[model samples]
Target chain A: MPEKTVTDERLLELLASEFTFEQGFALLVSAYKQRLYWHIRRIVITHEDADDALQNTFVKVYKGIAHFEGKSKLFTWMYRIATNEALSLVQQRSKHAAGTLDGNNSAALLKADPWFEGNETQLLLLNAIAGLPEKQRLVFNLRYYDEMPYEEISELLGTSVGALKASFHHAAKKIEQSIRAI
Target chain B: MSKNTGQELEELSPLLRQMREKGDGLEVPHDYFDDFDKNLKQRLTERGVRRHALRQIPVAVKRRIWPGLLVIAASLALVLGAVRHFNTGNEPAELAVLELSADDITAYITENAADFEPEQLAVLEETPDAGNQSPAPEAGKATPEKEEIPVEAVEEIIDEMTDEELAELF
Candidate 1:
């Protein structure tokens, strides 16, 4: 027999109910894990950080499930949480680096990472992106890599669509300048 | 790239266009997502069990503890109420007096006048003394003197005043 599929509403209903909560949550994790992992990976710039952030995001979602008001799409809400967790991890890493003699360079870290398959050109592009301010970097990544629409990105970041567009434009200009310098 | 200043990079620069075409180059271990759910479930289960253990107190202990907790809560409430009562001094008693009827006030004054100061008794006695006498000649029939106001009516006006107004009056 074919596996049964559940709608997001039905899944949420099951999650809220005592009998089916665990199974519903497991289904929810499986559905979004890969997408969320990549989204996090793009921001934090490493698989390990992405993994930690992803786990933290899921744990938070599980704990806060009862408070989920269903005002937004489940994925949008989860994306917001994932984004926060990723940014928080980056903030921690930045703090740690600021304390050390050698500041933590994510570009160098990415280049050294065995899992990264990008060539020299890709590395240059990534380094250029890494030079961006946090908000601009996020705007660039979500726009360039994820191809997320400005409206959805606006909802996710609580930023205006016009501001997001401006950030992306500035980010692109900066990246081009960085790439030329490289 | 330097030659193309002010031109749109997406259109002018092949590298910029290529970078856009070629997405972020991140990878994961083979079949990572396949086992990710199982691993997450294990962690969640372990966490759930840990949380459950923390939440699970012995019913016998709870039964014993509840009476002690209730006693403590009652003691706290009593302490707080006494503190509030003392803090407000005689305001509550005055409010209670305001709620009493004219007959009740007369009876209270008759019983408790000995306990009160002469000045306090004079304030209480002024109401009935004025009511028994005829109205003053200069006074309009429509507007009674403040002394001619019935004790009940005076109390009603005081009762209508908010706490701030009452505080301001005192």
Candidate 2:
């Protein structure tokens, strides 16, 4: 999946001093839409919600670009934002489903649904991941689904490498527990 | 602990190999990545379009650059105005009083005389019509009613104060 679009040269040039928020914004959306959407989907578990959250994330990035300090990588920043969006969605769902259901219960609910057409391993993985706590769930998705390194995840989440390693360790244990249960 | 230190563990390899398999329960259609790529690129393009739309917003009213510039300009203007006002406060008429004292005034008057009466001397600075340059008044009849230094008084002072004396005084 080695895909490179506008080089930093053209990207910067297209985004040079003349960049009206228009071209730069368009280029950014073109570059990141799908990656962000899938990242959101992996966490949030609904295509429609993922779509909405993705659009909202892009809009947020578009509006906030002026404040972008460029100290971190753009993708890392974007991944952070997308991660936030997904977590926020989950938080909202948590609020709605609060005492009635926790993440594991909700995962069970979604898992039990007959309409789920996903492959068995994916369902198993999702079920196992769903059984994990929210932070651990996000860590697992980033490490496993998005195939992101702890270093990048650390940068995005502003956590220390040691803490992330611990988190990933705990998450892997939980997911393995779920898989073994399956 | 599932946190295997070495890649020697068979778990990760089996899982990855399993994920690659069609029946392993993660069978994304062949088009999944393609769709993901397309969707992502589309999102990125949408973002680009949004940025383009945002750029279309006129920059004249932008707060980041223009407002800051306006504030700087206003600050400079205020500073300039203050400097000018303080400079005007130090103008000649207002400043002249600072240079005057009773001794300087008496010295200016004692060295010369052109028959100015005591009344005229009393009203020397009040001579409203004496120093009228538009028309010459009678030599001694002109009242000291305006800001006028009489020509005869000037002449007498010039005569009494020789060029050397003037130089020495200066």
Best by lDDT: 1
Worst ten in a row by lDDT for model 2 chain A: A7-16
Against the true structure, what is each candidate's TM-score? 0.58, 0.52
lDDT (tens digit, per residue) of candidate 1 on A1-182:
11225556556756756667777777888778877888888788888788889988988888877666666667788998998999899888878777311113766778768778887777778777776777788888777766677888888888998897778778887788787885
Residue B45, model 2: lDDT of: 69
Model 1 Cα lDDT, one tens digit per residue, B1-170: 12122233465455676676675677898977887877776767878732111122224334545787899999999999998988776666355544544555456547655655676555555545534564656655564323343546456445544676455444
What digit string (tens of lDDT, one per residue) describes model 2 on residues B1-170?
22333331135445533543332132233555456535645666665743422222223223334666789999999999999999874553323423444345345556543444565465544533333543666688864343444544444434544555444444
**DockQ metric, candidate 2:** 0.04
Instruction: Give candidate 2 misplaced runs (Cα > 4 Å).
Output: A1-3, A16-20, A99-116, B1-170
Q: What is the TM-score of chain B in candidate 1?
A: 0.25
